[model samples]
Target: MGRSWQGRGRGRDMEYDKGGDNIGGASLKKIETEKGVIARFVIGRSANKGDSMDKSIDAENSQTDDFIILDNVVEAPEEASKKVKLFFAYAADRWDAQFYAKANDNIYVNMDALGSTLAAHLGKPRAYIGCMKSGEVFSEPNQKWYEPEWWKFGDKKAYFRHAYGEMYVITNALARFVSINRRVGSKKMGFQERTPLMVAAMYGSFGVLTYIISTGRSDVNRVSSDEKVTAHHCAVSACFVSIVEVIKILLDASTL
Candidate 1:
């Protein structure tokens, strides 16, 4: 007699087969926010199964007409791209604002007095003040008075005082630039000489004034040196040279 299929538990076997089919049907889902689209793919346990599932999933999950995919990666739309660009642009602008704020603070701290002197002398309706750090004044004849005469015989206090005198001279030169230009009735002027004022103020010498004026840079019209005329000695002339170069560049760019 042949064994009955039912007696062999074929009904239980069918139930197990149905459960296995349910597991194979489980899928991984991908959703795109912008397009409001959903993609579903079957999950597989083996490499071959995974490969088959990938092909099936890709076919079922193809991008809609409004969306695009390149090399299995989503590409941003024009609007989204524009938004990203705007975000970076805003960030850069904010950074620049912060940088300028810090720079203005530094200018106020170190160069406020010098700036004020320049403004007063320039006599322009408006002026932008800038600062530079200078070293000891040059030893040239025009710069001798501003340069310390007795560097070899000073204590620390005397040395510091001498240095401060040089700083004052530099400030005076900046002031002189403004004053001479204003007197000439030129709002936009080129470089001018402040060496005479610097020399007379520091060394009580009027002869150096003629020498500085001979250089053909503008000189203050007043020839007499008295209480009203004062000069500040500069310790380091190199600093002025650099500042001049920077100003020239800025002026040229503004013209362009």
Candidate 2:
């Protein structure tokens, strides 16, 4: 990989303590691939007025404000492939962009790298997309491609399971990714093909439910390919009482 880095805002360099906590105003972490591919890593706390880091950390603890930059990464040697995979796995599962405030400097500085890296990895594209959405990676929906070629129709259903985990909020990034990848209406996930609506409903993500329904891409009335579950069925069975509005949205969309 190339050694050149285009540094953005000025940041202080602080060494990691034994426990791996950043001691200064901002933390700097460097990721070096086995073949010696190194990239800049920087994380900043969110400044959104009402956003809390605690609230974002749920049972799964899947979110973080850690904005990372890999766009400067040129190319990796063959030996570093495994290291790259491991890094993506850790980043996707541990530190997503869900709870961060929009327009933060860390995110703004590395938007292109963030989007490109997330889209390249298929193992947890949803998680990657969640992070990107949290950062508002793209101002317009059509500016980027968020999915890989392997994400066939039924794959999203399997992927939807991860959304229920902590830190995976229902952001426009998720919706936009599904729309662009043409996985919005897929029924191929499991023994029963659950649409995006059912997944959102089961996960009790009202924002995702509303957004998918508004897109008019999901078949709100269609039952699962095997289980015969509709979005309403998922809502009722999943006990999504907190989002009764989702039920209403699904109901209204069905009539149109």
Candidate 3:
């Protein structure tokens, strides 16, 4: 008598034989018969499901063109491949949806895994900055509502957005990240002695502007070297309705 197999998962499907030939201690449930010999049979416990299922069951070719049963494993190529490629697909989809619609199909790397792996590959400071800029947020949940900084690779100080006159609203996640990560506050040597707070304000990243000021990383009245203009000046000059919230943050900070 062979041991009875109990499948795991909420609705896992498992096939077995009622009374097939016993091979060793396991029963041989022949999937196919060719030349009077059994074609395929299962031999081990099913693989546990995790982020990826470890293929534990073993089956042998019984003689079926439609399906290949290794030990007792019968898997459709599409189904099996999806399990293996789940994370990769998920990461790629997120990156695509958030950043570039045109290059979505071009990306093949697994961003979920890439977030961890790439961080390890980069220098300590750079790795941290890289993941943050890429919007990976390893420590925090990358939820839709938890918007991250719009910063990206090579835009270390968010200079490009300011230089090109682009504006954004920073999210709570980005605010927390910058507020907690002190190293990110280090100002870069640029044409304008614009602190991260100044850059955030200039680009109209209200959440970041508020956080930087509230965290005391920047003096609300701090001015740029070139123009001597403060965050308040920038918000007023932008004159966009979206900047209204940023203006409120700046005004409140100035009073403090």
Identify the leading candidate in terms of lDDT: 2
**Candidate 1 global TM-score:** 0.14
lDDT string for model 3 (1-256, tens) is 2322111122343333333322212223231121111211211112442212223222211221111122222133223222112212222322211111000111121122222322232222111111011123222346553324434324342332121112222222333333344233222211111111111111111111100110111112222222333343345335444534453454234321
- RMSD to the hidden true structure, all candidates: 35.5, 21.7, 26.3
lDDT, candidates in the order shown: 0.23, 0.24, 0.22
Superposed by TM-score, candidate 3 places the C-alpha of residue 71 at a distance from the truth, in angstroms, of: 69
Candidate 2: regions farther than 4 A off: 1-76, 98-256
Q: Please write out the lDDT profile of model 2 over residues 1-256, one tens digit for every residue.
A: 1111222112332122112332111221231111111222222222332245323322112222222322222123321222222222233343332211111111112222222322333233132222211111223345583334333425332232322211122223343433344332232211111111111111111111100011011112111222332333344324433333342343234321
Give the C-alpha miss distance for residue 84 in model 1, angstroms: 44
Kindly list the per-residue Cα lDDT of model 1 for residues 36-84, writing each as its tens digit.
1111111112234435544543443352111111121111221222222
- Clash list (residue pairs), candidate 2: 154-188
Name the runs in model 1 displaced over 4 angstroms. Answer: 1-129, 132-234
Model 3 C-alpha RMSD vs. true structure (Å) is 26.3
What's the TM-score of each model vs. the native? 0.14, 0.18, 0.16
Superposed on all Cα atoms, model 2 deviates from the true structure by an RMSD in Å of 21.7
